[model samples]
Target: MSATATADLISRAQSGDHDAFRALTAPHVRELQVHCYRMLGSLQDAEDALQDSLLTAWRGLDRFEGRASLRTWLYKITTNRCLNARRSAARRRAHEWDIPGVHPPDPTRLGEVVWLEPLPDALVAGGVDALPGPEAHYERVESISLAFVTALQLLPRRQLAVLILRDVLGFPAKETADMLDSSVESVTSALKRARASLDRQRLSNPDREPPPAPRSRSEQELLATFVRAYEAADLEAVVALLTDDVFISMPPMPYEYEGLDTVAEFCARIFRAGRRFELVPTRANGQPAFGTYLRTPDGTSNGVGLFVLTLAGDRISAMTRFEKGVLPWFALPRSLPARGGLPGSRP
Candidate 1:
């Protein structure tokens, strides 16, 4: 919109015109939500923070002096809100295993960031454009991956804010400093420390092979093969598709299994009771995912969990399982009737 039109809209909004306020902020809501998701690492929390930020903006609209673009100003509000949420002690806690009659193998280690959540592909496609700016070190896709986000949650809150603003969102150092009410030198120092810490966490490794292009024939074939093997409970077939360094983690539950052998053993224990699953294909965080349903004796399948796969080239490198509570976020149903007595297949 032209400057004059925006000024008029701002004037109307500042005069308590709710419609004018919505019009002025509608263009930015999705991207701002994504920014919150990156900072807080939970879709629900992001939505909460976004709502809180918008409310704060609406209440404080008169203070918007038009010095920065409205989008940047919205981001400023959203980011600070997320930082406050992160600093709170009530962040989602790790969940204990509640699956009846299923005992998993001992995990290699306990995951520290258990509140990590997946971002739906559709939501991301709606909000994110191309890379934010020239200073961005990570591509839009890599930046949102579970590995990257998990690593982000480990940083000091200020360092996290600075790194995301300077590197991921590509905000200039001075602008980031202004947003945090810190000096440029402070922002620069925080970003430098954040980058080194993140590299040590292996958020991105230069030598790693990228996954197959989204929805490419190769990706489709790999996903299909995985689903078939997984549903059939063919441990050997499933294990064949894994990279040697593959790991499996279930959040909410802190258990994490690393390496092909350990992950294979965990799968073996899960299937030891002849348990079978019905897999529904989906995508999360730009990677292939599935809604896993446990087959029941009553001729129906019950939603059990969501599994998101991370690929390195054609091999599966990581699998992250979320509790069934996340099913609705992916638009997956909680249950499905038997496949007319035929073998279950992808819907």
Candidate 2:
């Protein structure tokens, strides 16, 4: 992981050693992908950008003269690629989620009321390579949560990068300025603007209180109950775990379902249709998650999507379901076995 070691690996990789290239870059890939996600807000886009950055780095390896650390060089390339991607025509197109045969929930139930993307908690929590400075000052998990990321999307791109590089990623002001190719003073100004914008936004959310730390006993208990209720297909039990004013949304689709009553109705309808769910536990944005699989009466298992739960106190405040294509990002299978012993499940 040292500069010399990286240089040697790069040399070997450039001389036709594929294994060397993998060895050199494998350790940083996961975290780098997460960085890409933060910049792009789309998992698919992040993966594509990461691949592009890697290829660019590989092809331009000869030009990389040790002026910066290999990690820093790759980061520069990756960040530039993501920023360029954000400016592309594709970014202007509104991304939509397609959930076959299901209507989107009403918008009244959404917490922050944004059409933001879903990210795996494991990806954010597990990938923390650039943790510079005091650990005490860094609330890494909280900073990367869905709530925080959505808020970040509201800021100007440069301010977003400044805040992330300085606060979330813990880079110093000087280093952040260097990365963004701005002066330290400009980085400071951008950070202030970003913070002010986020503060104004947060003030609008009446329920936006500082959440308790993750992995507390209460959080664990809540997640456990959710898993149990979901696995048993117990609609009522699931409703019991939700806050009275809970919100449910399936992104990439326009529907939003709000309140305990409405969410209960939605769940009841699905359950009444004899649709059973298999909840595979996972995490996203520092929140508990389940890779949701639907089982039809015929016993076929189909990949419904990913359900990422946001916990407030001991109750479930929000549930954001992402599309099936997101499964690969978390290393989940495209399809799973149905509960009723059916082969070739739709998933």
RMSD of candidates 1 onward, in order: 1.5, 4.6
Across 1-347, the per-residue lDDT of candidate 2 in tens digits comes to 77788778989998878899889888889889888877777777888999999999888877888777677778778888888887772442434645445444444633332335667766675576456554223376766677677677667888977777777776678767777788999989999998899888752346643444677787777787887787677887999888877777766655678788888887776666566777777778777777888766566457778988877777888888887777776778777644433432222
Count of clashing pairs, candidate 1: 1
Give the Å error, residue 210, model 1. Answer: 1.4
Show model 1 residue runs off by greater than 4 Å: 205-207, 341-347
Candidate 2 Cα errors over 4 Å, as ranges: 10-22, 92-105, 109-117, 121-126, 135-138, 203-220, 228-236, 257-275, 331-347
Predicted model with the maximum TM-score:
1
lDDT per residue for candidate 1 within 130-239, as digits (tens), equals: 35867877788887888888888899999999988888988888789889989999998999899999879876446667899999999999998998999989999999
